[model samples]
Target: MSASVTSTPVDHAPRVPAAPDTAITAVADMARRARVAGRVLGHAGAEQRNAALCHAATALRDARAELLAANARDVAAFSGAASFRDRLILDEARIEAMARGLEDVAKLPDPLGRVLAEWTRPNGLKIRRVATPVGVIGMIYESRPNVGADAAALCIKSGNAVILRGGSDSINSARVIHAAMQAGLRAAGLPVDAVQIPPDTDRRHVADMLAASGLIDLLIPRGGKSLVERVCREARVPVLSHAEGLCHTYVHAAADLEMARRIVLNAKMRRTGICGATETLLIDNAIAPVLLPGLVEDLATEGCTFRADARARAIVPDLPPATEQDFATEWLDAVMSIAVVDGVDDALAHIVRYGSSHTEAIITEDEAVATRFLNETDSAVVMWNASTQFCDGGEFGFGAEIGIATGRFHARGPVGLEQLTTFRYEVFGNGQVRP
Candidate 1:
């Protein structure tokens, strides 16, 4: 079954303790309030929802100083992996981008109440598939407090209520950001409960949220393997898995060296911590000798460490040898794996072997080769002559993303406004009965 859906969330809530009993009641109550708010938001017209989004955008922009200040505290107090620390920090540009994301979501066409499809039966019965909200969604994420803003805004725009559980490291920033977003909802006459974060930075509360099966219609996990694995394992509600974006970029024989060099750099280094960053680099044996040196040198110059397979190691003699484990890993940092393949078939086979079905890109000028790679690679997002990083909701014109789904069913790639909706069949009959 598909998992996208939500309603309004609660706001200005105080932080509570992480005790299991307290967490059970508090998270359950949060779900209860969100359910009530979701009903109201579900039927709210486009104008009202759009106004709420605009207010949210304004609120985010106005709260920039406060957000940056809060983020500073969060960053200073953080003592985790540098990759995660990077995700936690929110500078001026990032905050502004969050605000613009809200504005962008506000400008998109309303996803609700639209007819997706229609058909007429022989009995003169007309039926149409119309989009509707999924009711209440539980978003359990770690690090990256901006996810709070993005998730909250997208849930509001899609007519779903979201219950956010940001990482404990980002608890303070989450609380502040959640409050500012709620202020916008309140200002726009929307229910504050329509978008709620945990009252406390409690891990127990996350368990409570996971166990709240019937109350939460869907659960989306956005984080590292451990976090996503825990949610998928414990959540009683349907969980949408983004998985590790073990993304890759294949430098094919037909690839233009210049284009391949640029795309590889951007795909890997543009934002190493993001899920869309290519974790593995595959070069065709036909082009390995010619392309590997320049490309390897370019990335190395930018402080990227390379782990290469035997075939690729021949081309870059000084590169550290990659293990089987390296090809399967999602470095989520500046580290990446490289393998040399024979041709399109070889590259495709390797991707199928190691890909997380997240995103994959092929840098080539030949339409036939690009088409083969795109068709053969079983990733949610397959790119041709472009960076895998483009596999984002905003780039796809969805304002911001809740997360990118790697699952094959329901939704894949970027989960945005349209992906956050469900559908029902509405039938119009002229006093007709089934034969």
Candidate 2:
């Protein structure tokens, strides 16, 4: 006999106020509209979608000054912490980059309806595995207003609908970008709901989107640890959570001192605010005394602050002391933690203990060591003789990305256009049935 579990009456009681009912209903309705839009987008040819992207790019480029003015209003209104300000500020370069990104995505090969695999069975049956969009994607992100345009363009190009929830600090900027997206969609004869931004900036709307499991196909949280943790905990839907990127760069004993120095300096100081920037530096003890000072001094000269452990401090006595929290922190600023380990094994252990599994790099001429590090480190991107900052989608030739996915399943590493798609099997059988 089989047993079935049933919910009691108390379990079916009236819904408690997890979030406001009105906001929840609005998000739900928007999701429904997006889902319908996604169906239309799914069947639309690549030419049509590409045309939309081209129009969007043109619109953004032509209205750069207007967009900047709107972004300035949002920046002026922000009374939040410096961290929020850091993420929200938009300049002419970023807007131009956003427009160029849309143009790049428009030129790339369309991912929808591509045949992944095809096979024939013994019974003369044919099976085709075709790639399809993931339907409606709910993006809950912080600060960066550019993410609004990037996410919408990527989703539309891949034949999926996007519901963007940007931080309140960039609401005005997001609204302006969203208006451009709508114009693009309308120009291509697609529904404006294909890309929708939240009408309100209330945090409760985020809670509502998180809890809307059935309506939202996938939830992608892009921000700090607290936001990702909250979304992971509260979301009833499948979440592609992007946690803090505690990236690391290991300098092997056999590494070229010059190469290691260059790699370390670029990895930590190239752009501290990006997720792929190295937050920690691990040096083999054999090379620390010989190569440590130069690397530290080089980074310090470039305006990077270091928090060193006991072993690392022994090499540079004047360096600031690193706490247990420092190893665990993802200082998305001009800050990094340094440690001296014995060898590859020790380095691996340290990374497993502290890494967010986002990206890790090793500087070594030894093929065996490089192969081992690449194979062992369970990060989304494992590089050898290169900086961790190379872990970007644009750098990887994907044009642009929604963001890097630190999670294991679905999309790992850079979340590009191809990663945004899911596959389905289409089997063609000639009179085949189960016995």
Candidate 3:
């Protein structure tokens, strides 16, 4: 799940102080509206849906000043760590990126109404599995306001309506963003309820959303470990877990020194707050004496702190000794844990022990070793000579992602247009009766 700097979200919307039952009723009513909207969106033509996305993009761009103002308020209200604040603050470039994200989603191939597979039955009947929307998606996220826009746009393009619950600190920004999305829907002649947020960011509303079993088709939690765990444990509806990103970057014995240095720096420091940032570094013992110093120096120069295992500490004696708990932690900041392994197998074993099964990368020139790492590493995304940060929906050419699922079933990795859809069988038969 996404991490938040603040525990209590600032309320931007006016509150009525409703009873528990009232909150439940309100959530159900909103979900029912979303379900209705989802049906309309799901059956709409691809062109119409794309039009809505383009309008949304336009709306986002036009509302740039308003968004920036709202985001500034959110940032001011947030009393969190600097890294998380970085995630919350939005600038012109980030807003433009979000707008472009919607446009990019509009340009992608329509995921609906396509034939995923076709087969002929022995009885001369034609059967095809056709793509369809998952109906209504419940997106529970934190800090990043862009998540709400990205989720709304992706859900709209894939023909699903979304109910967003952004973190408390981001309530002001979320409201402005949600309004822009609705405006786009209205301009495109689509139901405005297709993209909705609750009246307030009450913690109780989360439970209400969780209990909306029949109303919500799927619940996707995109926050910290606690948030994901709670959703997966309590949600009555089907859930896709966007678990922690305890990612790793391994430097193999055959790794290019220059390449390893560059990849390691980018993977850990490019954007330290994101889920794809490398939290752990595993280096081969064979190359540690020669490669470890330079790598450590590079990361330290970028203000990165280290927690080192005995083997790693042996190479860099001044490094803080890493406890087992440190290896398991997702710092989500500039802190990283280092382990010196014997070889690829050792690296793999360490990863298996500590990784979140999210993303991992190997820095090596040997094709055989790269292939082995790629094939053997049990992660949603495995890269060779590249940064783990590349495990993003946009980089994968999906425009933007709803979230990166760590779960095994249904959707895994970056959830995009295609991942947002499930398929239904369409069978054609004529004059067929029981023999």
Candidate 4:
């Protein structure tokens, strides 16, 4: 699904400084240079920007050996949970995806200077809403060094400067990739500072970035629950984020058993470590007896644990009881939670209470049920008879995404080049003054 955000509210607050420590000072310096870089990049022209992106894609391909060596160091140094290491590790295909993402962005239509809205006043004045860059954006993420490349490429192509801060585990890999992006910018005769990565990944630098209100026009956090929570809570800059993805897939009574099974399996198990992975499965009570048991047995054999509510347990007899906390948790792993709802209405109520508003899916053959589920659900992306895993930018043909924003205000769903730009009103008049 495409996002509908064409503009955002301007942050009118003044910048305030924290204690003058060396770490924060360095981060602030980077923000200032990014602002300057944004100005230069805004005028770099679409041709120059596309050339830069092409150069970056080639650079990544040429530097494949060096990139892998750095990533190996990152993989060895990771000390977090086993699931987290999955995000840190990079392979040849992942690097290829990164490069292709840059090339894909270059192929997208220029987001800037496009007229989004236009009108004429009775006083012979013509006004048009034109897209403009959002200025300097700070992309803070934990793990997933590929995000560093994607973020930089999107911001650069959309006429905005960017400051990247990857998790410490992938800092070395991030540096190598960030340098390649800078080389591309310089080769295109654009400012190298257009895409800057902090020299250090200290926690203090992240704090500094949160308070960099004036320097950073927008804050996009791409990481786990903790990282996203910290940014949303303390960030002084305007933020576009969702704290976590407690995504769900509801299997309705009218759903075809085969379609329901395939959709649910892929939704939860295709890549459980991602934000789009479905964590909770709600089966319509009328159909639970006919369908839930076999689905559980097959997934159990495939290494997925099922935590179910009392009603579901009564039918299946083997699922571990799901806790209240489990219903609200975003388990970015192979564990799945199951529940039985009375009908489509009950299913929607359960989702409202426990869902993250990130992504939700309904498997149903009834047109009325599918339409209601899609219309009534308050999520960034909603699906019908499709896996929630499809809520991705590359899948939407945007090369790659900055993040899947669940915030309804500035940006929502898959954040791509279009979501990254805001608009300004351009008025044409023959020396007309306000009456």
Best by the lDDT measure: 3
Give a tens-digit lDDT track for model 2, residues 1-435: 111111111111122334445544778877877878888888899999988888877777767777889888998988976645877888888888998999899999989889999999888889999999999999999889888888898899999989999988788888778877876776777777788877788787898898888889988888889999999988899988678899999999999999999999999988888899999999999989989999888988988888999998898899999998999999998888999999999999999999999999999999999999999999999999999999988899888888889887888999889988999999998789966
Local error of candidate 2 at residue 184 (angstroms): 0.9
Off by over 4 Å in 3: 1-24
- In candidate 1 the C-alpha lDDT for residue 329 amounts to 96
TM-score for each candidate, following the candidate numbering: 0.94, 0.93, 0.94, 0.94
- In terms of lDDT, the poorest run of 10 residues in model 4 is 1-10
What's the count of clashing pairs in each model shown? Answer: 15, 0, 6, 0
Q: lDDT for model 1, please.
A: 0.87
Taking the tens digit of each residue's C-alpha lDDT, what string does model 3 give over 63-142? Answer: 88888898999999999999999999999999999989988999999999899999998898899999999999999998
For 1-435, candidate 1 gives per-residue lDDT tens digits of 111111244443333234466434778888888887888788888888888877877767777777778888889899998888999998888888887888888899999999999999988999999999999999988899999999998999889989998988888778777877777777777788888877777678888888998889999999998888888888888988876889999998999999999999999999999999999999989888988999988999998998999988887789999889999999999998999998998888898898899999999989998998888888899999999999999999888999999987689999999999999999999899776
User: Which ranking of candidates, highest TM-score first?
Assistant: 3, 1, 4, 2
Per-model lDDT: 0.87, 0.86, 0.89, 0.87
* Model 4 C-alpha lDDT per residue in residues 158-230, reported as the tens digit of each score: 9998999888999888988887787677667787778888877778889989999888999999998888899
Model 4, residue pairs in steric clash? none
The C-alpha local distance difference test score for the whole of candidate 3 amounts to 0.89
